[model samples]
Target: MGNLLGSWRFKEPSTVEECDSTWGSDSEDDEPAVEDDSGVSDSVSPERERAAGDSSPQLAEPRDSLPKMKRSFYAARDLYKYRHSYPNYRKSRQPNEYRNLCFYLNKIPLVPDGIYIEEILTKWRGDYDKLEHNHTYIQWLFPLREQGLNFYAHELTQDEIKEFQSTREAKRRFLAAYSIMLDFYGIKLLDKSGNVARASNWQERFQHLNESQHNYLRITRILKSLGELGYEAFKAPLVRLFLEESLCHNTLPNMQHSVLEYFVYTIRLPATRRQLLRYARQHYRPAHAFLWGPPPKRRGGGGAEGSVGAGSSGIRAPAPTPEPQRRAEESSPTASSGIIVSSHDAMMCQELGGEGLKSSAGLGSSMSRLEGALMMAGARGEMNDYSEIVPL
Candidate 1:
């Protein structure tokens, strides 16, 4: 312990004269010969050490950088990838809200413009000879038509139909009013020869009707009236419109309702019903409860085995009959159209539902499926070729 303490003694600085004398006293040969290896230790500077210390850690190498499949298998495992919300076919509505034309017209005052229809007709009786000559009446007719006074508006000439500028809301209201009037009166437009006005190309004049947002409702209403009257001449055009996603899928909930209502009306005809049902099948949704009935009441006895068997078939049975046709008078507006939408359909409708056949690609694919379905159902005659036509 004493020897170790002696070895730890501190040294004192040499005098200036002694340090000066010893500074260069020893030659290079006299200094202990230093050995040099590669001098690699000198290469690492303080700056490099600081930089290495500050750098972030690197990620580990991927286990399978280039898998055989180009597609991502992990994507399939994500449950959300395939999950989607269903569309609402019959969204909830107030009890008083009317869906039928007849009841609505019957319930509302006939004097939609705050004046009697007979009085207006009497005032304009002088202009009866030359309908266009009564510019004031024509002007009055258009505003009232815009106001949804369809009963009175229907009395106007075809020239009036042209004169009435088309708008989305205006067209919808007019059609709703006009359709009810037609249903009530059973009035038919006739040519000079007393023949039903049957122009093969009347639909052609309004070809661009549904092309824009402004006129879509107008076209939809016209199509509905044509269908209600059983105007089979417009059947092909209606089918073509069905194929158009833009026309079928609209932002306006009422517009969508009109289209669906029109579909219900059109399907009363056996020929169009088959095609529409076929379309509904491929795009089967709980919202389509109106058309396809409640999802086949599940059978508890079948369980998984039964479901597997049903799925194995991959084809559903024919749908049930839709509700009755619209009642023109006495029925509440909601129940006006004899069509009875079940509670199940209403329940299925989402808060933001009513988007039907909204995508062209989806529509085309579904239509193809429908065509095949119709062919199998022996509806070849009803299958009108709609390939070349673009309704817009």
Candidate 2:
């Protein structure tokens, strides 16, 4: 015991004045762990080593050529070993550690405000104005497993996904929330068929889409949340409807860039992405190039011909696969089964696609007008400034 004490010269705990330079942002709770590990170093000068008659030291000593300055005691510790031991790391790494877990998973509220998942849906029942005006509740309604605008809210968990997929009641409420949001955007959710179309009140909603700048971002989040929560079949029809409104109806003019660039691409499932890309190509007018960015390069049939190719330029092209079903859930955590474009949409593409191009007789003038529209879209603040990767 005496030799153990003597071998390493342990110093007295330094005063706050002495530690002012060494101490950092580490919380008070962390001090106990550091002291318990007792990982502090006993760095000494060569003169002290000579005074103690010590010929060897375990750690490499500071080189004599370097200027002798006081080393930070905190710096001398093996920081990386306990780097993840911090409280935030602890909570984020094992989210379930807290007794208060996600309401979707554990039926408990993890955050302080503590609103029940069902209560929010109940409040917004058939009330489009409340749904339209309230922005904070959207993140709660679509709880993703990432940072969102509502910093106080907890993210959805894997267990939440697994649980949410199983619970009919939770899904019912979730579907209700989705329905209200769809109504707010002038789209109608056919709950029986699990499909959506432009709502009866679409004219007003369409006008709202024209005026509201932030709804596109919200739509991106809504698609990502739907993908995350396993409503695999629901994303595409809404996008296709928006696309049709832009292309055939000549309404929603500003949304063409968003629908093609962000909306279709945010669907994490590869098959869904391919289906939408193929559908877009079928009705793709040459004027679209000047509107949205250029189309994805057409490739040979080895991979799915419609496969969007990703490059260093930031286009997320999932590699083409001949067998669409090969992209199993395990291969892509967020991929799910769905058809974005409806059968009616396909028939419409067959009928009106040719007529629209025939109507667009002067290709040269159309491209020029579309080019002006593109510039005006940028001026209108609808450019693709936010290229998000909606991760699992």
Candidate 3:
């Protein structure tokens, strides 16, 4: 009896049994769990076991990471190129603002100011002093997709475009307003169409634009507005005209970089922009086989000109009295309907996002990257480029 008493020891509290009592009977929805190695009876299901796992933490085993595959440069480029997986789709419209734009287009006076669109286009016509000096009217005559320099004016919306395009009078009035500005720049909007030709008084008007500082900014606004408001047909031709006289003719002197950077880049439509670039690539006439020549230094403080610079600022200058292949009556080389910007020649938009497409040959800069993004905006088929075929 003494030997038996010496061998015996006090039983430790059974924690597993306590745990089973607390958790096991609570799983009313789950099936009963089979007994583990423990001798303690437990009715706890797997779900219940997981819920009460903090009491007896069961850690998961760590996972091994998969090895990354090696790739060739071209292979990687093709694989990771910008796919434009997302789109910029607008959800709402500003009704009051849209109504105001319509009213302005229709020549109806708006509210207390009683300002109609035509008042600015006609009353201010040929007054370069007023046109250049008074900044508020430009926003009204040629509005923008985004806010303009004038804060009081409303920026355009998609609804304005849809509403304006369906109306004939609005389109006609818009073109008329466009014509007035073109005339101011020494270019004439062709009768009954959105096209342009050099005005009869081209030299004087052209000289003012050539001399004035504000015209280029207005030109950018015009291009952006035309695109936003569905007069996209006007954009490519205008850009082409600028490129032809500036880049190809060298008539305008040191404007190669300015036109490439600001004027052509102002376009919102990607297809039109890429078409213009391809035209530039064709007409650039680089002095070296490798490097492009530096842009010429500007004179008269960035604006001064005379004698059509090299040719007419007209929408379609008679093309030096017309070639046998190209008619005198035929539209300018950058006409909207004629040019088909092929998908094969599509742009280096993906390269800008660093997805690594083969880079374009020349003029790489932050400006180029921004233009790439603008190109991507029109990549979707939602909008179409005004396809004026230029007889190459």
In lDDT terms, which candidate is top?
A: 2
Best-performing candidate as measured by TM-score: 2
Residue-wise C-alpha lDDT for candidate 3, range 306-353, written one tens digit per residue: 111111111111112224434422455555556443322222221121
The count of backbone overlaps in candidate 1 is 10
Segments of candidate 1 deviating more than 4 angstroms? 1-148, 154-211, 228-230, 244-261, 280-294, 297-392
Per-residue error for 350 in candidate 3, Å, reads: 22
Q: What RMSD does model 3 have?
A: 32.8
Ordered by lDDT, highest first, the candidates read 2, 3, 1
Give me the runs in candidate 3 sitting further than 4 Å from their true place. 1-94, 105-114, 191-193, 266-274, 285-392
What is the C-alpha lDDT profile of model 1 across 224-290, one tens digit per residue?
A: 3343332434443344344333233431222332343233233223333334433433332222122
Better candidate by lDDT, 1 or 3: 3
TM-score of 3: 0.48
Q: State the weakest 10-residue window (summed lDDT) of model 2.
A: 307-316
RMSD of each: 39.6, 27.8, 32.8
lDDT per prediction? 0.27, 0.48, 0.45
User: If both were scored by TM-score, which would come out higher, candidate 2 or candidate 3?
Assistant: 2
